[model samples]
Target chain A: METPCLVMDADLMEANLHTLQAAVNRAGKALRPHAKSHRCSRIAHRQVQVGAVGICVAKLREAEVLALSGITDILLTGPVADSTRLQRVPALLERAPHLMLVLDSHETARILHQSLAAHNRSLDILIDLDVGLHRTGIPPCDAVSFARALAAFPTLRLRGIQAYAGQVQHIRAFEERRTASLTCMKEAGQTFESLRRQYPACTIFTGGGTGTFDIDIEIPALTDLQAGSYALMDADYRTVQSRGCLTPTHTFTPPLRLLTTVIGTHHPSHVTVDAGLKTMYRDGASPVPAEPEWSHLSYEWFGDEYGRLLTPPGTRRPRCGDRISLYVSHCDPTVNLFDAFNMIRAGSPAETWPIDLRGCSQ
Target chain B: METPCLVMDADLMEANLHTLQAAVNRAGKALRPHAKSHRCSRIAHRQVQVGAVGICVAKLREAEVLALSGITDILLTGPVADSTRLQRVPALLERAPHLMLVLDSHETARILHQSLAAHNRSLDILIDLDVGLHRTGIPPCDAVSFARALAAFPTLRLRGIQAYAGQVQHIRAFEERRTASLTCMKEAGQTFESLRRQYPACTIFTGGGTGTFDIDIEIPALTDLQAGSYALMDADYRTVQSRGCLTPTHTFTPPLRLLTTVIGTHHPSHVTVDAGLKTMYRDGASPVPAEPEWSHLSYEWFGDEYGRLLTPPGTRRPRCGDRISLYVSHCDPTVNLFDAFNMIRAGSPAETWPIDLRGCSQ
Candidate 1:
């Protein structure tokens, strides 16, 4: 009804869902769509219904939201906690019976095993292999020892190995990104192979994103690719390049756009909009107005509530009532800012998708 | 209940309300608490009850929210135009007869005056003066011409000027910030003085923040200081050096803190919480744990739903079930992310304060 309402392109969203599925289908790998992008349970449900092998959530609480939405197969991609959020596990597992979790430490394995002793059932666990991303996960070589240590926890099952190549996701160099992806996934693949020989029934080895979806298809070992942003392409994701890999650039049409209204025009050369940092994310890049007509005007940051966009010299200046459509620098947090989305088609407002999983920031 | 909830300290919030009142009372300035910080009608109502001259809002829709809350004195600080929102303004005026609107554009004044004429009445307006912050305000020198331009619309009443010193608010150095505040506000003061020498009845000279609250008390000409962060001091505001000023920062404790439960602790050295960029504002400063014990651990940028906190080198780590309290970097946007807050007291179950003003991004 007003400016700053998140506009989701449902048609493009479905296209993104299918695109990820198509990649997984061709690669003969599993499709586990990460829910971090949309964060909405309804979107996760759609991804599941569209033949995703599993949905990957970043937190245990997020896993709960998805599980409550009737998704049975899910992987809480981050390290599963023992003392911190493990209390939510049983309830979450009860909501959705078949759920998998990632483990990166021995203490976690011990805690989960001991905590769930009453059930005496091994939870589906995947050893998070740290290939290159220094953020989290264990080193690939340390995967076996950790798995053996985790085996002591009879209730925690070491299912497979997962190594996400995030560093290669935004690679601008084509050949460099391809080599980087293969090198990282190769280590993950080797870890999976070593673990499989030890466990005899190791099945899952998943990694790769929109950037490596094409290259990962050739790496015989990765079981699945977890890519999320492919649906609503952003300016940042549009730059992903890799030699012999999929062209992430312009592969998916950009669907989401923030419609903001010009509220101030005192300085003829400068205009202010109702949308500011609170309405958009500026961590990645400055928001670009969709139309080139709104060009010559560069959006400038003016605190949290005001944006002083500089109008190009001799260009058409924005008036007080003009509605300017802008593309957010990043998609995830920008979407998180809105409670509901105006899921629009080509012409009119179609359906209102309440970001149902909103305020579930936990 | 979720792991992370906005914990608003009502008692401290009340104190901050009084603090602003005292600052303005001493300076003989009108205290118009900016509603942009809280965005809650309940909070706006409280500010009105506590002798605030008016409530300053960033958006017309937000002004509508506060106006509907039965607040008679209101100031829509930012320029606004949507017919839907502007249409509501006249009706809002019906409830609160003394509503004031702010504008930076001649176009806004024209449209607003047109709307006011259509309603067969006049509306009061303040020309937003751009100070050193170089934000959504006209240059100080053009304050009168901008104010005088609205004279064509007989229905629009020129109600002095609105100059907000946002840059001086976060000046971390005490003496330097004090000097900068004087210089910035002096520039704004000169505009009001020059206009008054010509027009005679220039009534308001408003500016100041939590950072310059006590310092603003020294500006004898300032009619009122518009500060909202005092109600909920944050990590960024915590660094506001008010050493020389009698503004009593030691006693002015923060009214807001994010209560987060340890969600992920599978890692050995560090742990992860359920709050991330979505629950915390990263623009100003980093979040800190409320507990003094967590001093060793620092929060890092974890993806959407998780905050990766590094633990003290080799200490006995906090377990999964541990409840860690997080002081948000900035209260405004962090509070905007939630649908509700836990109106918390020291050692309390917390009453749910519905963030009724949330999702009002426009």
Candidate 2:
């Protein structure tokens, strides 16, 4: 409830939820909002209330936390390799009952099967396919064999495939992003079709993030869209152009922001704020001042705990104790830095939501 | 306890504690290790046991966490701007009777005085001076006036000057780092001399990080060294060359690491690990494989939850489920991402130490 805290605009977030869900529904696809972005079960519940089929998490710990928070439906998009983490999956399944995991290799499948077999439980498994990201997933050529191998295990039920083109999610050019996303979706569609022929039981096909959700919704291959950042857009995502659009369409308002107070004004050209890399995520870009009056001032990383705002000549300089909202470069990692979100509704502080999965990365 | 958790080598960390503390002591300076680096009170307690006179924290929340963990002497190196945060300072002072805060402006001093005056308590205040970082702190020319303004408040006790040259802490050239640190120290010394002439009670002159701890210990102006990274060297600090050393001298072995498991091995040239920017800090650089066998494999950010290891021809390829330790790029932010440290002792799993101040960045 103070400076350097994560602030969420309830109205803007609600608009994002309704708009994106409506778009996905119009495209005849389900929306499984990725909880890794906000990491708040309250937000996830809101997404579910807005007509989300389920939620997707990136780690077992995230799944466990969401499950404990009473989120019964969860699809873990990332693979769990360590035996200790794999062992926890069955326990999570008992709580969330509708938990599904994504797998890429036979070795991981074997481990998951063994762990679930010991618990006398079965888990839904999705074959992750490599769709030009070259990050994770098995190749489409190997999808059939991988699915068959996973299906052989009685403790595992073969779901569809997961092809996420994360690298192309933030392409600046609208046509370029659309082309890249369509190409990957086409490949994933071919793989899903091949797998569907082999095992008719395969139905769930999920992938795509906030950057390509609109494009992905148009793809018949993706059964559900896993867009996480749309609800709380950041500075980096705001730069991305929509399909056939040259500039950011403002389809989603940046609901999440970092509230910081000016702590020092030692130099004539710069002032220091309380939030820096430690409080805000510094992956894609530096945070920008959200106020229109401070648009000329550029933000720079002063230290781990301080951010320096470069005041150009003739620009209105910030004074000590002045509070300002900063649009973060990235939202997911920034949300992970804090323990709770100071929710703002109707222009005032409403309530605080715990980032239940804040440090649940193990 | 599990893969993707932060691991600390106890032996290496202990050696670093003794070596750095002995170095500072030999130079006739007290060591107040910065808890922002590890955020674990157990490690801070170990540093105190090895001769650290006090500890340095970056936020009021961190001060409260450390004080609750029984670390009574704490110097909060960052300024608190918000009224809500300033009000918490008195509560922290109750827990940490020897609590000190750094201030840069008169506005902040007045706020602190007003808050503390209500509780009939006085706090030790250090005038933060600009040491070329231009991040936080008053310029040397304004130091005397600022100190006088702060001394006018009965609730505030002017302790000394805090001149931290944070920018020069990671300079690759040893002479460059030393020269920059010395130049700042000289200016600070001049300011301290001026302040001492008026108030002889000013004695606690502190500033300098791990990169310049040896250089700072030699500066007569600095009464104590605030070296946090010395106890747990990171990949970025390891690149800092000593006074005349060409390569990184093992002043401190990188005791902290992230243990990740190979979760996907679809491509022959690349494999995906469970830890990425989310699990490991990505401020200074990307994490590298710790083992010699995987030295040829370079690490890259695959996504939020996955790290891609690029294995060139002739390099040993990792298979799915193979766990390896990764040397983190930065220790402070990386440690802040975890709830606890999986401390390794004598090549075995040891006791866990909670990162008590992991998200204590209010």
Candidate 3:
């Protein structure tokens, strides 16, 4: 019985998987959930079993991990440059065979072409377009020519398009979030139409994450969706615009919780918990208490080992040795801190679920 | 090999241990380097071998980890609570026999006393004082009474007073940092002075950390300094207030590096790296290129696995597959994210150093 263990709900994870699958089906679109959120091959395999056409891995290493686990189709949602990753790519492709890596420009296409030619191999490549999020991806207007050039490359095949609308993911307002999601997908849709005309044939146009998963589901040319983080929703995601849209029936249940114990009573109104910056992801914000009345209590991170609690004056507090649950601010990185998620059912002996992806930082 | 692994320079770590030991010797302060930094029992053992009086563990689980490794003298610097940690305490004591757990309140003291008495065991304790951190520890005014009252607990021994100046750690002004460190020590000194006068046989007085290792070297009343992270200086610690006084020793050898490879040439001026927020600590800031000038590339987090780079317009770019070395922004959490440290020596193949203290997060 370790304090600060990651508690995961298997039932909830199953529900979330069903929920995302239903979302894609209801929208009549292909599904390709991102693997970065969970980084679990078991989860990846589950996604595929539930009808996700492919998986989106944040890194080639992640792809390698999943590919070895028998996930055939994967999209490298993020950029890849390093020679080591390039050399490793062919091996992963050799294993997965149905892999597709995303790229944003002709330069990336050219690099892939040259490098793959040197290795006497070809790759399935998708042109990532800057639909709305300007983080990566080429401009949508430049998609056709670039897609054509990448399509023409002997060492690479022009798949379709990839656009992840990060800005839409956290949108809390229903109408506004839906509008933003549509706006982002609409921009990518135009590029897809142009590319479709340019090639005179439809390619595999894919993109959209949990935030915009529903948005791209019905997009005219969008062949699939790349949704991650829906299985284990975080506090921040719960506050997003789509939070309401994800009704209990449609909700991607949160399976993750940080089970930490009261470590010290520093103030009569404050206690220090072992889950701090090292245990929790303090990037978005501190987690909210699971108890209703404990709302007044907030977490203050002063160091890596200690998380401070500012409880309401005269609030009935738990004594030393009491356990409290924390809803992580964000699920992805928070889970990254854990080595395993202790799967606990109501009144059942907890089972250890190794977060196989926890330290898979590579 | 994983693209980004937490690699530790054993040579550098040993050198860091020596540097701290030398400072403690020169300053005449007792050494108790905090174990939170490396979170490795092996590293803590090495520190003890290098003449450290004891090791400071920030959490109950950390104490368990080190204690299991046969560390006799250990201090739980923060708080200890939860039935699991409490029940485990006696077991830990049976093995180590000399472990001190800190408590900031009588409530927790009562819990510890009752819990220990139930087990017919007693544990040494330190009264943590809020020297300046304001996060944990009782206020200085309340520390003495808190420490004095804990003496009545049959199963708990109020062995000493623990005070730490977290702000002083970041005070870059060398003289100012020293001044702040001394002032903090003086404040704690006053509290200890009160205890010294009241309890004529007060046998223990402990305080100090990596930032104040030199400052507390010879403090008359302070018996220990809990400086950790010295063995692995990160980008954040390198800039701790730019303290002008403590001629910033290049002592923090940059041994731990994330060996990443350039994955894609998405942008013209700069290439996107395969490693992103997932691979390195971005708390202080993104990892700067080890050879910044040669790379002449600036980084922006594009996505989970993508670090956007903006190279100078005319600069030669990193082609696909170029290996890039990066330092973590904060060493501890970054280390916590990795399962093992790749131990690379000058002539040997990289060996795997198990992050034995990793899952000990609980």
Best by DockQ: 2
lDDT of all predictions, in order shown?
Answer: 0.76, 0.87, 0.73
lDDT of 2 by residue, A49-94 (tens): 9999999998888888899889999999887766667878888988
Interface RMSD of candidate 2, in Å, is 1.4
**Order by lDDT, highest first:** 2, 1, 3
After TM-score superposition, the amount by which residue B21's alpha carbon in candidate 2 deviates from its true location, in angstroms, is 1.3
Error of 2 at A255 (Å): 0.7
TM-score of each: 0.89, 0.96, 0.87
Model 2, residue B37: displacement in angstroms? 1.0
List fnat, each candidate. Answer: 0.55, 0.79, 0.64
Best by lDDT: 2
Taking the tens digit of each residue's C-alpha lDDT, what string does model 1 give over B1-362?
Answer: 55677888787888878877876776666788887788788888788888887888777667666667788888877666666676666777887788887777776677677777788877777778877666577888878787677678888777677877888788777888888888888878888887777766567777777788777768766777778878788888776667665452554688788877665554665776767777786777888777788877887767566677788767657776577787788888887887776786665655776666676767
Docking class of 2: medium
What does candidate 2's lDDT look like per residue over B213-294, in tens digits? Answer: 8888888778999999888777787778987788975778888888988877777878888887788878786687888888
Distance from true location, Cα of B335 in model 2, Å: 0.7
Q: Which DockQ values do the candidates obtain, in the order shown?
A: 0.48, 0.73, 0.49
**Residue lDDT tens for model 1, A1-362:** 58866787788888878877876788788888787777887888888888888888776667877787788988888775436467567677787777888887777777677767866555788988878765567888888888888867877777898898777777787777788889888878888988999997689998877767778878898888788777666656665654554664666777888888877666666777778888886556677777778767787777787677888678888877688877777777788788777888875789887776666656
Candidate 1 Cα errors over 4 Å, as ranges: A80-95, A105-123, A134-136, A145-158, A198-201, A242-248, B68-70, B117-122, B146-155, B190-202, B243-251, B261-271, B311-321, B347-349
Model 1: number of clashes?
11
